[model samples]
Target: MLSLRGVRKSYGGTPALRPVDLDLVAGELVVLTGPSGSGKSTLLMIAGGWETPDGGEIVPRPPLPEVPVDRMSWRDLGFVPQSISLFEELTLADNLALARGGPGGAELLEALELGHLAARRPGEVSRGEQQRAAVARALVAAPSLVIADEPTSHQDHRRARLVLDLLRAAAVRGAAVLIASHDAAVVSRADREIRLDAPAVAPG
Candidate 1:
């Protein structure tokens, strides 16, 4: 449940995002689809407050609390980033424990068919398994807003379906799930799609 208005961003004087506006509502699965340099990831970063915008406004009206969108803790927000950041040193189960108050890690793992690999470390499992574990970790906390960047990029048809089902389940339970992806299959399953294009380069 958030809204962004006139958001803009740039790097080294070159624009990465044009002024953008969007509304994220509860219980919706929205996908951001676009070309390679379309700024979908940039917009997700800005919308989630992982990156600051040059000019714009984010007004987050979380249902239960007033936590700022950009400053939300893992408990209030679930995020599956492009890069897998699981702790390589810890077993998958322990990594889940380290989620800081998140619950239902085991169930999530089982749902993703990752239960057998729970005792393995990040480096010990396949990259796809690791990615699913990362997704499990994000959902363990039942966060109000879930933002994922190409979450299914590492899986085959079946596993990707599992991941999608899990994410859709989150939306059904009342979370706003926004995903950025180029996959047509992913786009087809979304309740809505926001297509993006390449941002204009800044003048020298």
Candidate 2:
């Protein structure tokens, strides 16, 4: 569902991703793995159309629509960013309701074990709960492609496994799932793995 060729990115003289190539297809879950500063998150951002790359190209396959990735609606591109951005003003269920119109939000909350806390706002829950909620919201819409950055960063083993299973299920249903994660549990469960490197720095 997505392809990147020779993609490069930099910020204020700092290198993020350097000449990276990646491909994501339906019915598969791909995980990006690397150390800090290796640009895993940057790659996810570029792939999601959230951050423009300085060079190279990002291509989408059929069913991904021919329009610009950024222009695609939320239902077509489910992105769970590295930083949790759940709405504090709305209850957990309501936050998911924004992406999905109906009971899907509730179903996701229940699956993530957040059903009893559906009425709680983001601020009222633990960080892990909020993180799972974010993941739930992204999956609620059942988008054609899913991009998640450090999705299981806040979870323990069991919870992390739960999240991974849901993502795998999404891929099984024919949606391409791309995730940036360093957690071994997350990487071990993916159908494929992409390793990135930190760009070399010139002497100042």
Candidate 3:
């Protein structure tokens, strides 16, 4: 389980996220949605340890005691940033392989209907294809915690459903999945939804 207690963030005295509390449990998929600048991405980044919050702490619990949650590494958490961050020099398959630590990239590609583009580099594929590839990479590692920001933004209805199904499957496999998206398709399929409001400003 991942829990955030009173998590808050600000930028140069401008509040981005207000005091917030959230819990992500294993075997569940949680969708975070709101308008632009509502701090959805900020919250996801904070959960994934990619960004620091001005206040509050994140506690992660690993299934096994041998691997302390506090000591968890990136392999313990799979994150897909809003920006599809793929290795431009490597083929899509190669990128997935790297994430998987070797082999098994083809299966994911086939599932997402990107098997035919496996040999192509990120630069060569369309943005939607690249986004799909990024998602596949995130799950290839089978991390305990999955954090994705606007994962379906570049996908169509069919592809979006495919991706959501994949995420749902990951949750069934005991991974806590947290996605930040405004798409109704994604929200409707989530086990739970967390809505964040943009920070309010005080009048001068």
TM-scores of the candidates are: 0.91, 0.90, 0.91
Which lDDT values do the candidates have, in the order given? 0.82, 0.82, 0.84
Q: On a 0 to 100 scale, what is the lDDT of residue 41 in model 2?
A: 82
Clashing pairs in 2: none
Candidate 3 colliding pairs: none
lDDT-based ranking, best first? 3, 1, 2
Model 3: lDDT of residue 102: 80
- The lowest-lDDT stretch of 10 consecutive residues in candidate 1 is 63-72
Q: lDDT: which candidate is best?
A: 3
lDDT by residue for model 3 (102-167), tens: 878688899999999999999999999999998898899898899888999999999999999999
Off by over 4 Å in 3: 61-73
Displacement of the residue 127 alpha carbon in candidate 1, Å: 0.8
Poorest 10 consecutive residues of model 2 by lDDT?
Answer: 64-73
Q: Superposing all C-alpha atoms, what RMSD in Å does each candidate have to the true structure?
A: 3.5, 3.4, 4.3
**Model 3 has how many clashing residue pairs?**
0
